[model samples]
Target: MESAAAQVGCLRRTSLSVSDVEGRHREMIVGDRSTWSFRVHYHSGDEIVHMLAGRAMLRIGQSARRVEAGETVVVPAGVVHRFEALDQLGWGFVSEFVAPGAEGPGPAKTESSLIAGVRAMLEDRYSLRTDVAQIADACAMSKGYLSRRFRQESGISLHDFHMLIALHNAKSMLKGGSSIVEAALDAGFYDQAHLTREFVRTYGFTPGVFRAAWQSAPRLPSLTHH
Candidate 1:
């Protein structure tokens, strides 16, 4: 697969990039302890975000959504939206972009079982096997079919979804003062560079930068409310 930068460039050239932000992308921004707010003006491409931590309100078009830890939402392209982190809960979001292509339309609503299973794997690291084929089998589907369905249901390929989960876990470890190499191993990545590559792709910053930002920020109350 092409690097995230290359993919972003492709989306930009195709006029599929979000206006303020250029290109199809995935990212996580660790907000400060205080509430952080910004208007999201997206021109093209769709977005699916899974909130891993904190509480936030998402304004999509004229509708407002309250999102808490473990909640997910979809923002269609061209919709004016904004997100604000409420209270002390520092937010972690996993986002993916969908460009126009053979992929067809945006992500379809996925079955609760599938979403629950995927979320479980992400949270309970022990339950997840690193092997793609094994995961597909566990889902009771062929690899190719699982990939297609995952893309259709999640607006991202199965591999990208798994990588995002791994990245999220790696970030948590790194923020907790783990070394990059150790974080990579704990997150199921092969090596530091491999984690770095995915980290940059998802967050537009290196893991070191992300870790520093997270560590220096004031601590938020734990997200025990769910």
Candidate 2:
């Protein structure tokens, strides 16, 4: 068999780098904590996250845990997960694998028509103060029922979903040269302090720092490897 050895994406980060290993989607990953995002995402296959250095607060589905250096977490296919590094630089590697002949991981199990409609509505009006009671009424359901079902399907509370959207908008405005205060108000935060608090909790960093990083770094280090 021909050797499959090949160097993939560049490591524009700290002196460390991820070596490509066959089978795993990525052999390793080493980057600043800012590289991690708060957005909950999933894979089409089993993902193995191995921490080589530092630590992070990891959320898998409704469960949250701390993953430290030398520890590992296995995320089953189609499960929602996200990570927030405990410190400025956390070194880790993530591997993805899908069994042969199995169906590809596509959508979350909870993506019903109702959930899709709800997602659309939130995406459209995320800046407004959400009234779940009204949303429930519109859907002809009780507040508690809608809340529980939405959580079950999205792996996030409805309020959090709104907040995430708001933060996303704020981050974009910041990238586009909006002042911190402007970004906060535009994204529906009560004030800069309000946006700052939520930004820290969600991104493990403050809004000012995020904007600075974006301003200072114009481009990702071209994905290179040894």
Scanning candidate 1 in windows of ten residues, the lowest lDDT window is 13-22
Provide the TM-score for each candidate, comma-separated. Answer: 0.47, 0.57
TM-score of 1: 0.47
Per-residue accuracy of model 2 over 36-125 as CA lDDT, tens digit each: 545565444456777767778888767789888788788664456788767766545443333312242233454577666675677677
- Using TM-score as the measure, the top candidate is 2
In order, the Cα lDDT scores of the candidates are 0.55, 0.61
The number of residue pairs in model 2 that clash at the backbone is 3
Q: Candidate 1, which segments miss by more than 4 Å at Cα? A: 1-111, 122-130, 220-226
RMSD of each: 14.9, 11.5
Error of 1 at 218 (Å): 1.6
Model 1 Cα shift for residue 175 (angstroms): 1.9
Model 1 shows how many backbone clashes?
0
